[model samples]
Target: MFARRALLGLAAALALSTAAPAQTQAQTQAQAQAPNPRVRIETAEGPIVLELYADKAPKTVANYLKYVDRGLFDGASFYRASKPPGYAPNDYGVIQGGLQNDPKKVLPPVAHEPTTQTGIKHVSGVISMGRHAPGTAQADWFIVIGDQDYLDADPKDPKKTPGFAAFGKVVEGMDVAQTILGKPVDPKAGTGAMKGEMLVKPVRIVRVRRVQ
Candidate 1:
C-alpha cells in the first residue's frame, strides 16, 4: 500500500511539473504573439510612437525595457545634436536622447547587438543606441532622421567595426524625429559630448513606458 501511494504521488508531481511549463509556454506565446509594445515619446514639437522590436532584438529590447521599467527615461531630455561633422549639418541629421535628466538611472552597458545579427535596417526615423569609445554603450540612444548607412556594420570588416544596434523603428513618429532634426543648431558650436549635453532645443523625452 505504501509503495503504491508513493508511486501515485510521484506520478502526480511529475505530471504537474510537465504541465506547468506547458501552460507557461502557452501563456508566453500568447503574450509574444500579441501586438508589439508601443511607446510614445512626447517631444517639444509633437509625440512620436516607437514600436519596440523585442522579438527581433531580444538583448536590445530587454536593455531598453530595463530603462522604461525603472522610469529612468521620464522627463529626460535630448541634449546632443551632431550634424555628422562636415555633411552640411542638415544632411546627416541626428538627435540624441535618453535617461540623461537623472544620472542616477544610467544603467551599465549590456551586451551589444549588431545590425548584421539583428537584420534591422538603419533607415530614416530608426532609433538606435550609441556606444562609448569602445564596447561601452549605456542607456544613451539616438534617433536617425535620415538614412544612416555609415551606422551599418561594414560587411567586409564584420564584428571588428562597431555597429549601432537598432532595436526599434519610429513607426508613427517619423515627423517628430524629423522635426527634431530640422531644429536649427549652431554647426560650429557643440562638439563631441561626454553626455547628451549639447542638443540645441529642450527636446525632452517626456516619458518612456509601455503602452498599456
Candidate 2:
C-alpha cells in the first residue's frame, strides 16, 4: 500500500509539471498573437483611429509607421474622393490622402504586399496603399468607404494584377472617413485617371501620432 501511494503521488506530480508547461506555452502564444499597434490621424474634419496589422503586413505597417513617426502627414491633405457614377450607389468609393507624391515628402517605394500574401482585404473602413503600379507605392494611401473586394489581390492571377496592400483599418471615427468621402469634388481639377476625383476643398491632416 505504501509503494502504491508513492507511485500515485509521483504520477500526480508529473501530470502537474506537464500541464504547467502547456499553460505557459499557451500564454506565450497569446501574447505573440496580440493585436498590432494603433494610431490616431487627426484631420481637419475629425479624428480617425486606425489599428495596423503588423503581423499580417509587417513591411507595409513599418513603412506607414515610418512616415507617422517623422510627421510626414502633419500638413498633408485628402486630395481625392472617388464615388460611384450615376446608376450606382454613391456610398462605395475611396478617400485618398498622404504625401501625394510630393517631391519633398515622398519616400522610396516599398515592396508590394498583396492581400493574397498578407491575408488582409480592402473592406469598408480598411486602409490601403495607393500605387500607379505594383511596388510603386510610397506615401500615398486610401481609405475604402465600402466593401471593395475588387481591390484585393487576385489569387489566380497575382502576377498580372497584384492588388493594393491593405495594412490597417479605421477602428474609430469611420464616420469621419465617410464624411470626408462625401466632400465635394472638382469637375475639372484633375486629368487622366483622376479627372473627376479631385477634392475641391481638400481635408487637411492636422497630425498623426501613435496611440496606446
Candidate 3:
C-alpha cells in the first residue's frame, strides 16, 4: 500500500507539470499576439505609418506619443535628408522631422534607450531619436532609408558610444519617406554637419496622430 501511494503521488506530480505549461503557453501566446501602437504621419508628400515598440522602448515611445497627442508635430516639417556623398541618394540615408526645437513646442528631453539595451537596431525603415548626446533627444527624430547598423551602440564603451534610441519602424508609406529623401537640398542652408542636408523647401507635416 505504501509503494502504491508513492506511485500515485508521483503520477499526480507529473500530470500537473504537463498541464501547467499548456495554460502558461496560451497566456504567453495571447501576450505575444497583442498589437503594438501604430501612428499615422500625414505629410504633404504622403502618409507614413509607424508601429511603435512599447515593449522594447517604453520611455521613448511615451515621449513621442506625448508630442503626437498634443499636436505639437502637426505643423512641423521634414527639414533634413542626409546621405553620404557619392552614395545613391534615393537608396540610402535618413529623413529627419520634428518641430526643430521650437521653444514653445519642444518638451523636456527623454532618457536614452540605446540599441544595446532595447535590441532595436537602426535598420531600413527604423525610426530613432536625434540627439547630440545620449540623453538630449527631444522631439526631433529620423527614419532610416537603408540599414545603418553603425548607429547601434558600441558595447566597447557604451557611455561614450551609446547609439540613438530606436523605438519604432515604418510599417507603411515608406515611399513617402523615399520621396522626401529625394527632394532638393540647399547647399548652405543648415549649420555644421547639416549644412548641405537641409531641404530647400521642407516637406510639411500636415498632422500626426495615433491610429485608433
Highest-lDDT candidate: 3
Descending-lDDT candidate ranking:
3, 2, 1
Top candidate when judged by TM-score against the true structure: 3
lDDT of 1 at 187: 47
List lDDT for all candidates, in order.
Answer: 0.76, 0.92, 0.94
Candidate 1's residue-wise lDDT over 6-57, tens digit each? 9999999999999999999999999989876778777666888888888778
For 1-212, candidate 3 gives per-residue lDDT tens digits of: 99999999999999999999999999999998888899999999999999999989999999999999999999899999997777777789999999888999899999999999999999999999999888999999999999998899987888888988999999999999999999889988899879899999999999999999
Candidate 2 vs. true structure, TM-score = 0.83
Q: What is the lDDT of residue 8 in candidate 3?
A: 100
Clashing pairs in 1: 79-199, 80-199
Please tell me which model should have the higher TM-score, number 2 or number 3.
Answer: 3
